[model samples]
Target chain A: MNSRISAFLADRLPLKNVENHIKKPLPKHINWLFSLGSMAAFLLILQAVTGAFLAFYYSPSPDHAYDAVNYISKEVLFGGFVRGLHHWGASVLVIVVFLHLLRVVAYASYKPPREMTWVTGVLMLLIVLGFGFTGYLLPWDQKAYWATVVGVKIAGTAPVIGDFVAKVLRGGEEVGAVTLTRFYALHTIWLPWLAFGLIAVHLFFVRYYGSAGTPKNTPEDMRSGKPFYPDQLFEDAVAILILFIVLASMAIFVPVPLEELADPTDASYDPRPEWYFLFLFQLLKYFEGPLEVVGTFVIPTVGFVLLLFLPFLDRKEERTSLLKRPVALTVTCLSVVLIMLLTILGAIAPRLEPVPEQPPAAEQTAPSQETPEKAEEEAVFDFGLD
Target chain B: MTDVPEEGQQRRTFFKIGMAAIGGLIGLAMAIPLVGFAISPAFRKASKKWVDLGIADLLKGSRYKKINYTFSAKDGWVETNKRRSVYVTDQGDGTFQVYSRVCSHLGCLVRWDEGKDQFFCPCHGAVFDSAGNVVAGPPPRPMDKLPVKVEDGILYVKES
Candidate 1:
């Protein structure tokens, strides 16, 4: 049976070519850290599959979007599990992509011929963020609505064509039905298409240039590189299995929550972006008004541009070692620390004020006779009920 | 090699063109409804109209009363009953000020703090005076006021 199956595959396709590709030797230093890229790829597939399942039940309209989601969670079989996987998978994909980029940076894998790979990887990271942002609005919940409003508003703060960009993003002057439908289309179709295309290019470059070995590995160690099929592939498979278990456990135990339906007219909603975006959200707090453009556009743009061109910026011929690259190490460490600090601050930061004490209904029924100064003073100091 | 027969070559050319034309027609036939279905939502206009909140007498005196009204909003193929809330304060003199419970900074619900003679948003520390003016916190504007009308003892609010 095996012989016949092999014979049929040989006749129909280039099995030998696939074997040659898969059996190529990888660097001896390639370990679990190197598996992060594969894990991201695996998670992308998982997201697409689970998202497709969700798309079957999800309604894109503002009116039915929330109901549809609720129905899926409460009515459909294992629908909540699927949604949970997709949600958690998306969050994990962001982390995996970031860690993969960090691993590449630490190994100086973005050097020389690997520049295009690094560029494609960075684009993939942005696409993943695009996925997160667009997907957040799909649930049509209060959190999704408010966060999107703030997000679109931040986009509206850009210099020159900011309003145009914001209008295009929201599909109107405000976050309404049109905005929800547009975000749904982008999340389910356009962004995923772009992600897949970029992934193809990224994989092609990885295959073309080959994997970069850790600088710590000796020349002899490099010479004894193991075949990818049983060695590197084994480690990657093990890592993916562990990731699947973790994701499944999370899905079963801590399912994603659905908040109240989005009400644009509601003014009291507190808008907070996703945790991955908390850094940018926190950064915006420091720069107000005209300087807001700095946090919203200039800084992020500069940071991304610098990242995209890091391979060109760090032109060095020496062996790739983080210890030898003080500037790169320092910059990377600082960025990681800053983002972590900002995210922590964003999570823990208190709201502007506590809930004010409510006065008795009878006292409220009576018209206020106090002067404007007294009223203002009462507003400031009186946490106690009247 | 001998030259091919003209009739046979012509027949082959005709078949190729015929096949191409048929394929093009089939593609167009398939694309019309598919594309239309895909982008139909973009052309949909928002379905919004004034919803009545019942008798105006329910909102008497200077006291603020929370009123809930339900309206059916249609978006594409789906229809849903949307619940809306407004804080109605009768000015004792005949006029009424209807404030939406939504906070101005974000879209969270705001409750009237009668003690402070203002509206307090729990999501943020934004405070709005009874008249819906921004009194404190990070709220960029005061609470929004819905257009209200009293016709034949019925209070109606224009919602969009």
Candidate 2:
């Protein structure tokens, strides 16, 4: 029976060709750090699978979005667990992708033939962030509404075409039903398609050029490289198993929470972006008024552009070690430190003042008789909104 | 090594091109309706209807009275009965002006401040006078006034 199956596969599929690709020798220096990329890929698959289940019941309108999510979590079988996986999986994917990038930089792996691979990886990271941003609004809760308002407003601070861009993003002047629908479409359909295509290209490049050997490895280690099928594949499988256990444990212990349904007319809610965006949020605090555009757009754009073209910029042939590449190492260290510092600051920043309690309706009458000075003293305005 | 015949090489190239073309055509065919279904919500228009609030006399004098009205909204395959509120202030001249409780600046509900004699938004500190003019805070405009009518002493509001 096994022979018959093998014969059927050999006749229809390129089994031998696939075997030739999978059985290539991998560098001996490949270790746990090298598994980050594969871990991220595993998380993406988890997200797609869990997200498909979520999309089955999610309603993308202002009226029913919140309730649908509630129904899914409380009513649907194992839906809360699936959602927790997707939520935590998204965050973990971001962290793993960042770590993968860091590992590549630390080993000077984005040199020469690996430049295209690095570029595709960067695009994937951006796509992951896009997923986070779009998915945040899917729950249609208070945090989603207010955070998205601030996010779109930040986009509106761009020079020349900021208003146009913001309008296009919102589908109107405000984040309404249309905005929810648009975000839902982008999150569930467009972004995933883009991610899948980019990931395919990224994997193809990895297969074509092979993993960049660690500069820390000796010549003897390079000569004693092992076949990927059993050795490296075993490491990858073990790492993935560990990741699944950790993610499942997290899902079981601390499931994702749902907030109150979005009330656009209520201004009392505090609005803050997701943790990954906290650095940019903190940066915006330092550059207010006319210079807001600098923090919101220019700095991040320039920094990312520089990082994207780092291979071309640092065109040295011999220096592939961290110690040898002082400039690159310093830049990487500084960027990581700056981002961490800003994120910490943003997290600890004071929240907007809470909405003052109102007197019970039964006991109150029109304050038409109050003195202007007393009324002024009693009035509370939202500082964050301004 | 001996090179393959020119005719065989050309045939292989043609076969590869034809296979890719056929595959692409199939992919396009499959994608059309799937993509259309995925993005169908973007093209849907929000259905709005005029809901009756009942009894214009419920709103009398200069006082703001909160009233709840529910209407069904259809979006794609989901139909939801959305309950919304509006504060109707009687002008004392037999004319009624209905204000959406939603603050003008961001979409927070605005409450009438009996002590301050104005509509105050707790979310952003936007203050509006009894006549619905922005007096202080970040509100770019006054409170939104809904299109309201009184036909045979019955109040009706246009809501989406």
Per-structure clash totals for the candidates: 8, 15
How well does chain B match by TM-score in each candidate?
Answer: 0.69, 0.76
- Per-prediction TM-score to the true structure, in the order listed: 0.67, 0.67
Runs in model 2 with CA error above 4 Å?
A218-223, A355-386, B1-160
Worst 10 residues of 1 chain A by lDDT: A354-363
In model 1, what are the clashing residue pairs, if there are any?
A266-B107, A267-B102, A267-B103, A267-B106, A268-B103, A268-B108, A269-B107, A269-B108
Model 1 per-residue lDDT tens digits across residues A1-386: 99999999899999999888866877677667988988999899888877876787688988788888887676565666777888898889998998998898888889887899999999988899999999999989999999999999989988889999999999999999899999999999999999999999999998877777787777566546766655566567667767877887787789798888898776556777889999999999898877989999999999999998888888894557776799888998999999999999998887655334564465455547667886675566455544
Docking quality (DockQ) for each candidate:
0.02, 0.02
The prediction achieving the highest lDDT against the true structure is 1
lDDT of 2 by residue, A82-124 (tens): 6787888888888898999999898988887889998898888
Note the Cα lDDT for every prediction shown. 0.81, 0.80
Position A85, candidate 1: lDDT: 81
